[model samples]
Target chain A: MDYTDYYKLTCSEIQKLYRENKASPEQVVDSYLKRIEAVDGKLNAFVKLNRESIDKQLKDLKEKKEKPLYGIPVVIKDNICVRDEETTCASAILKGFKPPYDAAVIERLREAGAILLGKANMDEFAFGSSCETSCYGPTKNPWDLDRIPGGSSGGSAAAVSADEACLGLGSDTGGSIRQPAALCGVVGLKPTYGRVSRYGLIAFASSLDQIGPITKDVRDAALLLNVIGGHDPRDSTSVNAPKPDYTKSLINDIKGLKVAVPKEYFVGGIDKEVSLYIGEAIKTLGSLGAKIGEVSLPHTDYAVSAYYIIAPAEASSNLARFDGVQYGLRSKAAKDSLLEMYNRTRAEGFGSEAKRRVILGTYVLSSGYYDAYYLKALKVRTKIKEDLEAVFKEYDCIVTPTSPTPAFKIGEKKEDPLSMYLSDIFTIPVNLAGIPAISVPCGFTKNGLPVGLQILGKPFDEETLFKAAYAYEQNTEWHKRRPSL
Target chain B: MVSKDNNNKKSEIDVGYVAKLARLALTADEIKRLGKQLNDILGYIGKLNNVDTAKVQPTSHVLPLKNVERTDKVVPSLRIEETLKNAPLKENSFFKVPKVIE
Candidate 1:
């Protein structure tokens, strides 16, 4: 096979080539490096490329036991640490801070002999939904360069969609993984909150953050998840539940499965075309012998509100470790006092959105106002979780649009923080409820931009989502469509 | 604390004070811009006030498990060189920081 064609293959497909003796691991890695060089300048998907590290990985693979992701190239979000490599969550404050240890997923990937592709850019500290807040600059959508690939996992989604890598690792705090997958025409899954370890994922809203797979299709998503999902004693929050072989759940049968369409997700602000596609998707599911009905999650309207408070509060606390003492950038003006050093280092290092969120988080958690804001948001979070629990008790899964709109212009919502916040509305509730959700391409708008259909399931029940998503995906051509790049 | 504006809406939040608490120093221009932005966002967040969560227990974590314990055994830790590899300013084996004492 030609080296140019290597970038188009999925994880399993690449493994097949190896079995056929048509391609070697080094050849595959070289193909991706060449492809990235040819296109990454335009997409800016990568913050840093592990050009030298690949040779070492390839050399190490020669001695490791064959595993699921062997020789498969995977794009990792910049926030996930890779030993001796810079893991700066696209924040200027963390510039030049290389971790001494690999991420949990990275360790798993290495154990499986997968190539460490490169670090994808992200919204600085995962604050923005547009990915424009990245200090390394925004990653362009593969579908349309002028538009944003939905973020804060924008780069991860775009990298996978463009076939820059077979799969990408993205952490979803709100809609980071799925929204970008929706906009970029890929499949992204945010596994049940504790299904995958967050041991090495740079914290952003810890209660909501979960690392998962972004891939070209549902099967690949499952294939990658099988390698990464499991209990890790390192991450106490990671569930100790039995790990299922996710690929076994990719049956093309959702017959008699109960799916609920949350009425609130479609009522207001959703793009007409996006809804039209999702409507067609619902009909497709019904035609596939699945039972479908409308259900109301009354707390849906307040998801974004509660999220802004809760996520920022967690972020403010998680990000406090970035002071100049340990690593990253230290303010040059930090000469007189420790407080002054901290103030100036953060002031100079943090971007506008980061500063806004830190302030907002501080305001909510501050004395005399904690009850009115922070505690209130936590209570609201309980209500949101209950809403999902109630629906899941009667329904097998819930379906909705991954995002309210398709890819919007890059600069369109960057200035308006509220508008930017609303982009993740449909995806935020899943995080608040701590459930699993997958975004698969349902169809594209008339403008050629892809719209995603989000399938959410009960906590620790990603298998059902894969089953349902696979059934729908097998019957649609949406996931097969690639950008003309 | 929120202060009522002329319209009787809680609109004024001291953005500068909030930034100080956050350990972020902002310029006057940033304070004004981010201040209005914060108020607009806070007004949006105010929607949560309508939910009757008075009787509801806050679900801080999604998992039901607690005290996720592991064996309290000592293991190899990062070497001093590796630990201090990222320090922007460092002494022999320690991170050098600004003097906290006056």
Candidate 2:
């Protein structure tokens, strides 16, 4: 196989190559490093590349192939902490900040022999829908330099797309992981909220954030999921459920599987091209012997609104620690009162998007408005969850266009926060409901940008999701297409 | 007919009050900018009131999951010095904070 093709090869294939002596772990890491050296300048996907750590991992893997993920290289969103590595979340506030220890997920990945590539750029504090808010320049879509790679996992998705990395770990609060995976034409899986540990991820929206995988294919996503998903005492929210063999069921045929297409997802506001592609995917599944039905998630229309209120409310609280004296950037010359020092420090440290959300969040959570906004949004959020439960009872899985549109020009929605949030309209409901969801490259728009079909399942039912997504992937050529970087 | 107005905005809200609640010490320009932004976002959110939610049960969480309790046993962790070393400011093994009051 061509060297570039090795970049797209799944974890299963890479492991086989290692077992058969056709490739060594060192070669895999070296190949990816060379690719990053070649293309990362154009993409700006990575903010830090820990070549030394990765080289040490490769050497250890060669000495003993003891771990499940031995020698597999993975990229991480800048928000997820890896000890001694710069975990900036692409915010100037955290310019040189390094965590003292690994995030729970990183610990798991390390135990499994996965080589940590480096921190990928993200929207500052993972607060924005587009990666443009990153302190490091925005990660451009590898497929089209002028267009964006959807974010806040845009850098992770872009790196995976450009052959800089084979697999990536991303934090999804709202649609950060899935949206970028769709735009970049890679696969990203957002496990149910507590399925993966969140111990050391820089908080964006604590209730909504889940650490997930961004990989080149479904099984690769599954393998990474197995390595990362589990309970950790360090993370109070981590689920206590037993782990399942996600890869063991990927080849299961999705025949006779009941997939629900919500009417709200297909309403007029969805992009014409994206809707057409998803409609075709539904038909393709039908042809492949899957049962497709129209199911109503009536409260779906309220997803984005509820998300804005709840996510920001939590974010406002979670970010209070970044006050000058604790960690990250502090204003050196502020001679005013202590409060002034705090404000000035934050003002200097955070990007525009982070400040915008902080202001909005504080407003919503204020004493007088709390009941009307924050509490009310929470109640609506409960209804959204109930709505999903009512629908899941009648279907084996749910399907929708992962995003409203394909990749747009880099700065298209930079100034329009509402428009940017709308791009995640379809994907947010899954997070709100705490259900497992995956975005797979189903097709491309006429402009040649990729479109993703979202597959959602009840909590812990990732096996069914993998089965359906794998079946669809096997029948389509979309996943086979590489960005002409 | 007796009823309570759910849409009433608390009448005491002023620029400084809102700014304080938002952790912002605003300049004249910021106060104006925020007043307008808050009003606009609030107006947009007010649209949620149009839904006939009288009989609808307010939903707060997605899962019916009650909080699971773990035994309150402590596990050994990394050394305090190691964990606190990266704090921007630290004194006596605790993260130092700015004094808010005399």
TM-scores vs. true structure, each candidate: 0.98, 0.94
Candidate 2 local lDDT, A1-485, one digit each (tens): 75544666778889888788788776787788888988899999999999767766766665548678888888999999899887888988887787888899998888898988898988888887678999998999999999889899999999998878889999899989999999999999999988999999888887789999999999899899999998886677787888998888788477889999898888867788898899999998999889999988888877887788888888888878877775677777575468877777776787767766777788778766686777777777777888888888889999999998898898988866777877888999888878899999998877789999999999889889899999999889899888876
Candidate 2 lDDT (Cα, 0 to 1): 0.83
Chain B, TM-score, each prediction? 0.88, 0.71
Please provide, for model 2 over B6-44, each residue's C-alpha lDDT reduced to its tens digit, 9 standing for 90 to 100. 645522225556546555545676666655654555555
Q: TM-score, B chain, candidate 1?
A: 0.88
User: Please, what is the whole-model Cα lDDT of each candidate in the order they appear?
Assistant: 0.90, 0.83
Query: Please, what are the lDDT tens digits per residue for candidate 1 over residues B7-96?
Result: 336856898888888888899999999988898998888877678877988878888887777888999989999999999899999999
lDDT of 1 by residue, A1-485 (tens): 68767988888788888888788888888888888888889899999999878888888888653678878999999999999898999999999989999889899988988899899989998888878999999999988899998899999998899888988999999989999999999999999988999988899888999999999999999999998999898898988899999889988988899999999998878899999999999999999999998998999999999999999999999889988889999999978899999999999899999998888888888887788888888899999898899999899999999998999998998889998999899999999989999999999888899999999999889999999999999999998899988
Question: Residue A96 of candidate 2: its Cα lDDT?
Answer: 77
The parts of candidate 1 lying over 4 Å away from their true place are: B1-8
Clash pairs for candidate 1: none
DockQ values, each candidate: 0.68, 0.38
Candidate 2 Cα RMSD after full superposition onto the native fold (Å): 2.8
The backbone clash count of each candidate, in order, is 0, 2
Pairs that collide in candidate 2 are A379-B59, A382-B59
Measured by lDDT, the strongest candidate is: 1
